[model samples]
Target: MERISRKAAEARVLDLDGREHPLRSLWASRAAVLLFVRHFGCREQAVRLYREKGTIRALGAELVIIGNTVPCFARAFREDLAITTPIYVDPSMASYRLLDIRRLREALLSGGALKHKLSALCGGFRRVQTRLDRSQLGGVLVVRQDGAVVYRHLSEGADDHPAIEEILAALAPRTSDEAQASL
Candidate 1:
């Protein structure tokens, strides 16, 4: 994986309080697992990452959830999910564009999307109403403090995300040579 682009790292997102903050701050102090969510109402991916927050932190990384909506929607998502992981909003979706996470019109009707919806329903997470773009997908990025993005998974459809094991492996310590070679 390559280091995060300066444009993406510098893209501004709003916290729940509506304050603008750069995305790089997320990994400045520690490695971070950044989950760019489809929307605030898509709880499937968010809940999955939330469940693994402890394991992620155990690897000396923080998990940050970013949604494409306003602060109110993000606040509601946090309350609805009852999770402590920091959630942010990018109403303009500039970060998504900079990261090359695209939107597919067929994503909503894809077989994988259907399977994910069913799985979320069976898991007891109800679908909430959202006005945000339904075609927009989400992605995962594992980034080190120095700005190297060790792992990146760009979603092909709604609810598509990288495996927990894959993300954890990216966060796992690597020897200097291994790290250098990956770069």
Candidate 2:
């Protein structure tokens, strides 16, 4: 896998409604949170994860799901929860590959390949496949307007991620007077 610099780019994204939107064109855009959900339909879990943690309001950032798993997520959240965040569908996996989150190759060569294939045949591949997609596990990345990744917590283990409060604290900006007072 090619190394992806731990930097955020000013890239264009499409919303669920197929409308083109840019990162720079958001309201009170203090920061942007990009959640890379694995599989083709895991939108529900992503929404639940965000809502349960109060991620949207706490972080005060635009929440974006950058993956092709919208079908799964949409079905899960649409039927139960109200998702306020925008979902971007990258069916080609371009974003996932660019982010170095594709684990299919590695999983195909690993000892768990057989199990994963069997699971796929039984319509349970996502559960098994997700265990192999290490890069997309979960992470909190703070990106400044200058396209710099100020902070990041990339974890390989499941459920090992930063809290919404922690992310908010990291992204909080100090006023010029506050900076001067501190000095």
Candidate 3:
């Protein structure tokens, strides 16, 4: 993923209710982890986010999930995952486009994809057909309160994700200590 400067990162994004808001508002007051999901139905990303929620929150960063899914699907997905993360809709995928995200076919024919598929299935995350665009890729952006993107991760494949430690470290210096403590 390319680094997004504060000047280039300003854009409008919609919420789950079709309300418009400046995307910068997410991280304007505090750090934020902007998780642009492939779709709410993608189990691997959901589960990963689900598992890491507390760690992310503890770092004093807001976790927001944006996607091309409709409002209804967004609600159901959040409920299913039992997460309170702020979810948003991007029907036109304006943010995705502006962020330069692109589809990766390798995600389909790779060992990582196979692992995630099986993991998702066994983990009880069934893929749902909601007429959403599955081909559209997703990514992550860690924005500082000043709107600078400190961390950005564009998916390389279906199961690609950034290292948790890297994300935590960027939010603050304590994550390194927290990680070592856990180990």
Which one is best on lDDT?
1
* Model 1 agreement with the true structure over 1-183: per-residue lDDT tens digits: 588899889999999999999999989999999999888878877777788899999999999999888999888888887989888999999999999988977637678878878888898978899768777789999999999888899998776678888998988888999878976
Order of models, best TM-score first: 1, 3, 2
Q: lDDT of all predictions, in order shown?
A: 0.88, 0.48, 0.76
Number of clashes recorded per candidate = 0, 7, 0
Candidate 2 RMSD computed on C-alpha atoms after optimal superposition onto the true structure? 7.4
Residue 37 error, candidate 3, Å: 0.7
TM-score of model 2 vs. true structure:
0.54
Task: Encode model 3's per-residue lDDT on 50-168: one tens digit a residue.
Answer: 57878888888888888787788888887777778888877777778877777765436478878887887897878876758867877888887776677888987777777777777
Clashing pairs in 2: 40-69, 41-69, 41-72, 41-73, 42-73, 43-73, 44-73
**Residue runs of model 2 more than 4 Å from their true location after superposition:** 1-12, 20-28, 40-45, 52-60, 70-80, 102-138, 155-160, 174-183
After superposing candidate 1, which stretches have Cα over 4 Å from the reference? Answer: 180-183
116-160 per-residue lDDT for model 2 (tens digits): 345444653244222123334444455554444545555443334
Worst 10 residues of 2 by lDDT: 1-10
**Best of the two (2, 3) by lDDT:** 3
Please give the distance, in angstroms, between residue 163's alpha carbon in candidate 2 and its true position after superposition.
Answer: 3.5
